[model samples]
Target: MTTSKAFIQPLDRVAIALMLLISLLIGLIIWQGDAVKPRVRTFTWENQQIGSEDVSFTLTFSRPMDTKSVEDNLKIEPPLAGKISWAGRRMVYTLLTPAPYGTNYKVQLQGAKDKFASQESSNRLVQPFTGAFRTRDRAIIYIGVNPEEKGRLILYNLTQEQKKVLTPKDLVVMDFEPFPNGEKILFSARTTNDQDLLSAQLYTVTTGIASQADQEPESPGRVDLVLDNKTYQNLKFDLSPDGETIVIQRGNKSNPGDFGLWVMPTSTESGEKPTAKPLKSQPGGDFMITPDSKAVAVAQGAGAAILPIEGDATKPLDFLPQFGLVQAFSKDGSQAAMVKFNTDYTRDLFLVTNQGTQKPLLKTTGSILNCQFDPSSPTLYCLLTQLVSKEQYIEQPYVVAIDLKTAQQKPLLVLPIAQRNVHMNLSPDGLGLLFDQVVAQEVNAPLSGNTLKTDDGEAIATSDLWLMPLLPIADTTTADIKPEKLPLNGFDPYWLP
Candidate 1:
């Protein structure tokens, strides 16, 4: 009986301790009483790299709150053009246009207040919260003029407003495309030895370097020969947006049988060797690598072929066998500008989509130089030459913008008939067009049998660069939307990727 009483006495003390614990918990609960301000769980995208597709930012908070206070207090230093919205505790800021690459941006929240209120005051986030981020490297690279600078790849930084030559001075860059990351430039260059233009090989030069210390060592990555084949000449090549594949149009110097589309892995198991296999198709003509990079729209004879780079390479989707050229594809690969050649060799331009038939835009008796689909809209910009006289083959060239919705074409600029190498380049924002024109005296340039030539013999001329706004704005009227000549004397101007 004595032992039983002893055990019961300890049990009673244990019960008393349990009761005290519960009372303390209740007191703490009463003290809290649901009085809390929205707390920042995290301010993300801190000093990280973003791309064009990454046009949105997310901010998470500890609790849901009023969207108005946050929107009013939010300020992006340097001011990014964007829109703001709210979702529960997340503050989403979406950019109307992608932030230009190679820049630092800061976002700040001042005097942010939550929806909840206490008896005495409104619950507010007291501290000024800030987040910092960076965009991918960006630049417009072009070939330079002057014999010394000619063929040199020029990297003009859009963000830094600086320029750097990326290629060796001895190499003359014919054409180039930048990888999506803006890190390296893949170019076709030939040795300045008066060598056959077909001797040009594919090479990559570093146009970008990691500005952040945490990134891969600030390496001006090596300029490596990506593909070198003495047997075949690499002409035009495109790197897939996903950076997994490189589709090159190569012409065998000796055998016409070797002329076709070649698919190669952009990366290798061993950096020492590059492996490229030919796609099972007819000889290549003009083609655009799809944004998805899995397939390419190739110009096969008078038709367009969509051939796959992987899986069953044997099968291809053929479209419009009468169309001689596939000028361009839309950003989403949903639409294309196709050109058909008549028996007279005159070209007719048509707009076709992935799910639709060819909608005729314009037909020209001269030639269709090049055409590109605007990234943000259904408009297609084209450079076409109109035959002024078929007898002498005299031509007048113009830059025209065609609206796919209305099927109306507007001539934006009319260039001199002699501007033979005219190329139209749209700005990254899709608001401006850059092109080149030649101003020269018509000397006794005897008519060249192949190309457009003057009745006189001397074909001496000077090339001038020009820029024109492609958009409607408050500052410029449509009548006043003339091409402004740039001081830069260059051609084949391409917007950096």
Candidate 2:
């Protein structure tokens, strides 16, 4: 009756409540030891858009997982075969083949227990997890063949059936190469009023397509000049696989004899325009950027030289004195399809590797126009011209797929002997091949404005683009696959990366 009323301050009451909560948590832990469920904490590719180069994805778990249990329980919709590896609580799945373009995929994980989960426990498995990712849309870029859209760079989405013109009518797009992201195209074009093809300058045009999921589509036909033709005449240009550098064959306007390869950045710091600089090396022919994007493979005097474009380009990084031309490099840069000029005028296609192994794949009596390595398979697709008629000396262009392991060759398409101006390209997904047959027109008038020609300089009368669906290397019935004539009217067709 005499004791004063006990008071509990706000701070004291909060501390008492926290202690009780801690005590309760400890009691629950003691009663249910190691019973907590595991879960997928994060998925690297979840709800994202990926390309053919994205060959692996990762999953991180809330707790260390049983590697075998997780591997056995993991499921991928559409059934992609891959290898699994583990690093602590993270799991990585590397695809044996590239995922097809314009496809959505799902990954699911369940019924997989954690590292410490007891076999006797009923609920020790990982919580059900589902994630999804999508590949980019299949698209092609070509200089339009129709009169209305002729000489303009055109982008057509094969998956969406959407088309957009990327260049203006006044600018006749002479040649173009897409950036790795497909958001822009590096092209050489001249004014419709200017008749000189050599007067063309280097430029980049927006495709009005988004390269990534988070990026908004750019406005189409937004043109930016990269190299002006005022001082140097830009001839042929090659964009690096990494899309950071551009190597352009340029000749001085004042001194036409002064010509060499000029290296420039695809983009520059804000407010500063990109400028081209001399490569500080001997002039060479038929140059291409190496797959690693660090060197240039050029046909020197009697051999092919790999010159480092990063620094000290004068010193050849590696020289293959036997090979006269570097046709194509595998996507990984580990192997290359090189051309060796023979004394008898025949060319030998050799498989050259970085491991110092050079194996002759085939010998070609005709020209090796182009060759591309399959991204997902050990195959090389090549376009060559065979001398069909010894009397007429006619060269017939044909495409062949060569198995790298066995050196077996499969003829894909044989073009008309007259279609020597034909151009071919392989799809990034390795599922299709694109080529065009051109009907050259006799131009009585002097070569002038907006009069497009085949790359071989024949005036273009018309062109038809064809697509050949490719079969998996495991398939025995590849002969049954036929070429489909696309509805598009274009030439020099190329697949968007």
- For candidate 2, write residues 145-215 as lDDT tens digits: 68888899999999999999889899998889999988889999999898787899989999887877878
Q: TM-score, each model?
A: 0.81, 0.95
lDDT (10s digit) by residue, model 1, range 376-486? 566788899988877888888898888888777777788887555666787655667878664443565542211111113223244556778667322236556778876
* CA error at residue 51 for candidate 2, angstroms: 0.5
Q: What is the clash count for each candidate, in the order shown?
A: 6, 0
Q: Which ten residues in a row have the lowest lDDT in candidate 1?
A: 448-457
Note the residue pairs that clash in candidate 1: 443-456, 444-456, 444-457, 445-456, 445-457, 446-456
Report model 2's TM-score to 2 decimal places.
Answer: 0.95
